[model samples]
Target: MDIQVVHRPGNSAAKLTLDAGESVTAEAGAMIAMSADVGITTTTHKRGSGSLTKTVKRWFAGESLFLNHFESRRAGSEVWLGTPLPGDMTSMTLQRESLIVQGGSFVACESGVEVGVGWQGFRTLLSGESLFWVKLQGTGKVLLNSFGAIYEQPVDGELIVDTGHIVAFNETLQFTLTKAGGSWLHSILGGEGLVCKFRGKGTVWCQSNNQRSFGTALTPTLRARSR
Candidate 1:
């Protein structure tokens, strides 16, 4: 199977070329296009009670609990995948490197990768953010989508990022979500908002824009009709 991310830097998508019998599992609703020989199957993995609970958590986190599998019925079958948001697309080749991604960052992944929920604590809850994130482990290429241009921040000691700007990070890093200032009033007024304090040597990916801020900006115009 061959996967390529094209039209990069903005408005990008993944074009996958699959050999006969090859298949890939993608986040539901990610398929934008495909060739005639490509076949699709949807599964919720409802075989176990444990997975059902996990599925519930994922649903609360703003993600579809089911995965769509695309297979090539004939040689050189092609399929295209994209995110709902307009932004940059990138792929990572993982070999046992666990990845924890913000909600809605995932697009697609090849076989051998396991997707699940990870790392939701009190700090995260206090920030009024989603309680869970998508976690990827095992070995395979995983596609990540961002709300805007994505930047890779290498952290050796400490790094702080606006909570809404985070995309994905490696398991090697430890992070805590907290208010940006010493006092609640200052935190609320300073425009610093919630921030994630990260430590240890690893990498963190952040988006140039914040989704909450974007939504907040639109709320006024959207609600004008109501007034």
Candidate 2:
């Protein structure tokens, strides 16, 4: 299978090409278009699993409880996947490695990749992120979508990132939630709030824009419409 990203940094889409007997698993409602020969199956869990517990965990990770699996019955079949937000999409091939994705960043993955929920503890909840994150591990291509342009930051020692701007990161790094400023009050007053402090050796993928910031910017307009 081959994955191509179209339209680049803004309003990007993932076009996946599959050969006969190949399959891909994706977040529910991610399929925008597909070949007629491709078959889609919706299940509460991954392809062959039926554990409701996993479904509930995925919900906590800000993903659909049900997942969609697309299979190509014939050669040269293709599927287009998109995200709810207008932004960039990228793919990575994992060779027996694990990736920790922020909630709502996942787009799709090859059938060989295992998708599960990773608990980040109460500290993450206070940092304005979901306590549960999507964990992908295995040997296949995994696609991720961001709210804006995506960039990779390699961390050999430590790095500080705004909690709201993260897309995903390598599991080799350890992250802690801390104030952006020296104190919590100063952090809040500075409009930065909590930030993620990643320590260790790995790469962190971040979005150029923050989804919460975008929503906050439009709050007045939405309120005025309701009024």
Candidate 3:
């Protein structure tokens, strides 16, 4: 399958074009447009679009967990899509031809195959691995956007990452959120309360700009309304 990210950084929308007969499945509400022959399906989720015809197998909103899949049959098929969640969903995992994304932040894998997880799940995935277990497959790229200036340290013994700034870390490192600074008073006053601590050795990807706390064109209106 051939794919390309037509839009650069800072754009409101990113386009993914697939070669003829190539198909890909992603979460629902992520598709912008597709060819007429393209097939759209949802799993136990509510879907609606004025531009495209939709069919529901089993529909649920808040309680029912749903995932969407789309496939195209003709070459030069294009889909304009973006993340449906807000900026809080900072991490995502793509594995086994499927993607698991958090509730905040927009995410897309231009091309590749891999699994991804957020700060919580990433710590769980790394709890058992030794320092040497961190691995990066053939040209697999994981994109993570944060809320503040992200910090990183090589995992030799322990590393700390801010809750809002953490993007993604290798599964080989064990992580937990602990109070930074000396005491509770210091932590609160210093403006550095809880930090994601990593123990073991692995690579951590962080963002220079905090995408979670900030706003983007893709940011949800509901979240903006809350603030």
What's the TM-score of every candidate structure? 0.92, 0.96, 0.56
**How do all the candidates rank in terms of TM-score, highest first?**
2, 1, 3
- Identify the runs in model 1 with alpha carbons over 4 angstroms from their true place: 46-50, 224-227
- Give the alpha carbon lDDT tens digit for every residue of 37-104 in model 3: 77766553222221111112112111113445456677777766654333222323434333222223
The model with the greatest TM-score is 2
Winner on TM-score between 2 and 3 is 2
Candidate 2, number of clashes: 0
For model 3, what is the C-alpha lDDT against the true structure?
Answer: 0.44
Report the alpha-carbon TM-score of model 3 versus the true structure. 0.56
Q: Candidate 1 lDDT, tens digit per residue, 1-227?
A: 68898877678889988878878888899999999768888876422223776777777767888878888888888989987887888888889889998888888777778778875876777676667898888898889999888889999999998888888999999987777889979998997778899999999998888777888888968746554
TM-score of 1: 0.92
User: Where is model 2 more than 4 Å wrong at Cα?
Assistant: 224-227
Scored by CA lDDT, what does every candidate get?
0.83, 0.91, 0.44
**Alpha carbon RMSD to native, model 1:** 2.3
